[model samples]
Target: MKRVALLVLPALLLAGCAAKEAEPASAGLTVTGRYPLEYAEQFTIDECAGGYSLVTIGEERYLVVPEDAPLPTGLEQDLTILQQPIENIYLVSTSVMDPIISIGALDSIALSGTQADGWYLRQAREAMENGEIAYAGRYSTPDYETILNADCGLAIENTMIYHTPEVKEQLERFGIPVLVERSSYEENPLARMEWVKLYGLLLGKKEQAEQQFAEAEQRIAPLADQPSTGKTVAFFSITSNGLATVRKGNDYVARMIEMAGGDYVFADLTDNGNNLATVNLSLENFYAGAKDADVLIYNSTIEGEVDSLAALLEKCPLLADCKAVQQGNVWCTAQSLFQQSMELPDLILDMNRVFTQENPPESELKFLTKIQ
Candidate 1:
């Protein structure tokens, strides 16, 4: 039987429409409207007549109150109230920190789930060095005292936090609300970047957030009409055991490649019901499928960058026979590309340049470096 594709409403296309008042919610307050998003599917913001916004992330709901706004009467006993002007936060999600920095709310963060050395954002690294943001331990083992002493208003964590429910429970037990950022779950690169709006809303920088998202949308405007470059590309990482880990056909990385006017070589790959975007296979199996690919892009976000065609061949000696390697058509992505959500469009443009051989000044290419 053929499968039916799911129809996901463009949370992006709905932006700027007049917000209509909806039915009265729990406290007899009607939802007046909401900040419309473009591609994001992981969360929503509904404005209420009582001057509060209801934020829903996954299955968790939060009531956001603007500074000096009165709390609505008779809210659900279990609902969390996130008063605005929030300060002293603990951020664990590395990708989330970029958007937080983009929204200019870095000062509000007092604790970090990632160590200073683990950060790729210069501002975050500098802040940690200056004692503005202290180490609060990783998600699996958070420092309770650091969080408590910092008076953490909220805990922004990644999906990995779910693996340690006790840590989340302990933070909540201490009155620190934990919000799991879900941008990584989005399958569309733009949808993932659209999370900037979510951060903007939370930090009271809605205008800046809107502008940031708009600018990124504009960056990919050419993609909406550009024809496919007809190039076949394979992107993967070599694991420690010599297995090749490649993205699923419908994964966001594959989608990004398609948007860049190229066809993903492994367009039919899937691991049934695993919910994993990537799957590992023997190097021989990978070679059988992609040996003739026109371009090979190494994902350095996982195993780090590899220099020289000879060095890559050392990792997978079989790849030395692949068409791309033989033709010297290989590239490597920057280690920080995955964490900086705003740069995915730029990455697409970089791929386009390689596929089309648009030799702009070398300085124009940001994320990808040629493998000599």
Candidate 2:
């Protein structure tokens, strides 16, 4: 019996070694499809903490581990990691700037989107004022000379600029790599936030990006579960012709309306990909559709007291009959809400405060404001 047991043990060990040899390398690591921006290429793997290889997929990178390896604490197993350090970067997208700031790599930024009075940009306004960072211009209309002459190593752009191939080629000609982040176009806010890992990779601040995303996830998940007693809401931005362009179903604002515990009245509208579409509704149609809205929030483009909400409402009598207006529920959302550098978590909290019957607790009310 002792001789048989020793023979069995050797056979078992040999089988285990054979199975290990048969397994494929790079089995558990993540690999993304081709990047939308043509300048980005494939990545190489490098050793990470705990005997794992950090996989680079263009500017978007991730960490890969053996299937048997223990998952890292406080991180989702599927999350990607950016393992390289970036230098002298310029950002052309407002949406891309927020994640970079969230990951604490704002100091590495040499140039970025314009510094408006928005909260997120305001946080970095001092840096711009002090000449530590320069405003490259609008994401869609960047000053090419400023970009070419500046000591920029990389440029982070959004998918919106895909139409401008000539401009993209010019930037590439100067040896400046362009990385496109498509999170804003994603239907889910969490999915959009997940792309923060991409920014973490470019900035070589993967750990910081992971931590920030986890915090944002924790903050937003509870709001999804919060009980609501408020009426359904719909968001509209006024057009020059006095028509209200309702937010479409899959737009980012529509997602925020859901996160704030209000049903977006236009959730049934199917034109999902249009960022800004003219709904072309008459005052009769507008009142019939949004008359019951618990809150009426409008984008306040005015910076001074001369043209207040009162003055603006007077120009559009169609909003006069709104329940929100009758009951004084009308509020002004900052134009910054439309700005890309604005963090989404902050935006969600603002929506909650605007639509909720009871005010949010102090911590939850962090970035919100009334239209007064």
Candidate 3:
């Protein structure tokens, strides 16, 4: 593998502010022996911390050290240790598939948690069909024997696996390291995108990751200073039992709405201590709060897609009184929105067009579907 020396430059942080450079770097392609992160606060690259990068995702922490680097001293047994050049990986996080594939390192993946038909990305689906990727059950109930037989060197899990601690332990018993990805915890959408840098570093594709993030940043640059449209948006989904689930105001989805020049309707629901992204609300309360919303985006990823405004109204008759519904300004997001993490920049641009235009050019929309 070719090694690329990449510098962590000023990147996007919360509040649309620029992140300060951690330290100055020498010119050219010399390995600095340090991995400096610009936006991922959940992890750190510290030499004093035993020359190992400490990554904290929710309550779980991991110590990631290079394969050739000396083991950090005084490390706790409770923490998972990940030695790098992570090949033969079992990627349990479906969202991370696009990022890994984008860097041309898809060959590094040996297993997937999602089935062929379940994948939204064409490359992932084809990989499974061609036997390049094998299905090893899901995050919670993995086929341990299949994983072991394949000799998976590392297992990259999402937060979903946090509920199944035994699974991690069982995998480790077989000598496979587990690293939980927490990019979803990022409050800023670009910060979440910047997580590709971490993957790049692990796969020795740091230069490609940096370039991808820079391009995504440039795509969102024009919307940074755009005047607010003052349009109020409600992004929600209906549960089978009639509860309305919405993203907390501080979550990345809500932040994306505000950044695109619209007001998130449920802004007051935000409580900093609450780390959960979605909150379930009574339909009555959902109606009371979102009735006057200027734009309504149905989170079809959770509630399932609706074919028409009539179908949506049938699911929640109370929504007819909502300003967005009355004005016929309702839209549904495709189920692929959550898995296609690489398209977030395009998603933001689509939202901006919807908030600012009376009739957006739907032909250019990537994730949103207008309710007829």
Candidate 4:
């Protein structure tokens, strides 16, 4: 793969700011080595002379500079620089919380964009209740006063931050680096989980992150050798307007279903490799595409789970005509399914079990529950 990087010129970066606009690595920069990677392709961690770690994510780049280390001279002035052992992070990206937590660096986060009650993770909720992590406001409306008071080192945001670019500008105006984590944009399910390695490096937990990712990789290794279950799955949930929100064929949901040895019934409904992972289908269209699917997995991460078959039918009466519905092969995802970003293998295993077994053990079901 082609290597693209940026320069982090300490001479040009404003004081207290960890990031700046990205520019290509100019004269006087040298590549040393890169942190080993497995499945993650969205970002890269490269080393330069004098121990400067250049992290490239798409067109943007960030350099992790060691404490008290003198800046590298002659590099481009546009790339951002983050001091090592970042602290007091104002995290607005909910998926990032899992990776940060997986490395035991939850203490490093000083503020959350999600409210106390908004978190599905117990550690996050407890952290907020115990005053360890406070709500600093949402991504669009951050509490600048609180963030400044906390001396926040970084502001981690999701793609939604793009909708409020002015807020990003304001954070930079205050010399606070705003990083938009794009793990959710990954097409591969494990690739999204692989971002844990990147967060591990940011929090100075490289070894732990590597171990976590390796273990997860090993756990799912056998899945590749498993024969296809010859079953088809339809993963979707009804939207507020009575439409079905479903994963596109190229989406991670479809990828996960395939890895679990099942076929995605809507595998041809791709978004032409765009960033969008899901597409909305009218009830009639969804039924036409998925009526004969052997399994129906209700994606409850967004709309909340239905407790029973009757509840699901009440929400979408058309499902009653589906083959999976008639055969009692319907299941609903747990509410925590999306929030458990670090548990990719476990989730894949859950899906695999559902496809291969007539009655998967209830005690072992982690991300899904069969509708009774």
Return the TM-score for each candidate structure: 0.91, 0.69, 0.86, 0.92
Clashing pairs in 2: 62-81, 82-201, 94-340
Task: Give model 3's TM-score versus the native structure.
Answer: 0.86
Q: In model 4, which residue pairs have backbone atoms overlapping below 3 Å? A: none
lDDT of 1 at 211: 83
lDDT of 3 by residue, 96-164 (tens): 988888888898888899999999899999999999999999999999888877778778898778699
| Model 3: ten consecutive residues of lowest lDDT | 23-32
Looking at model 1, the pairs that clash are 11-37, 11-38, 12-38
Candidate 2 per-residue lDDT, tens place, 19-100, comes to 2123222333222222222112223334443445444443443443333465333333333432234456677676666677
Flag the better candidate by TM-score, 2 or 4. 4
lDDT of 4: 0.83
Better of 3 and 4 by TM-score: 4
Q: Report the Cα lDDT for residue 212, model 4.
A: 82
Query: How well does candidate 4 score on lDDT at residue 197?
Result: 86
For model 4, residues 193-265, the per-residue Cα lDDT tens digits are 8999888877889889888888888888899999999999999999888999998888888999999999999
Off by over 4 Å in 2: 1-84, 113-120, 137-141, 272-284, 301-309, 339-342, 358-368
Candidate 1 TM-score versus the reference: 0.91
Off by over 4 Å in 1: 1-20, 358-361
Q: Please tell me which predicted candidate would have the highest TM-score against the true structure.
A: 4
List runs of model 3 lying over 4 Å from the truth: 1-36, 47-79, 272-274
Better of 1 and 4 by TM-score: 4
Local lDDT at 217 for model 2: 73
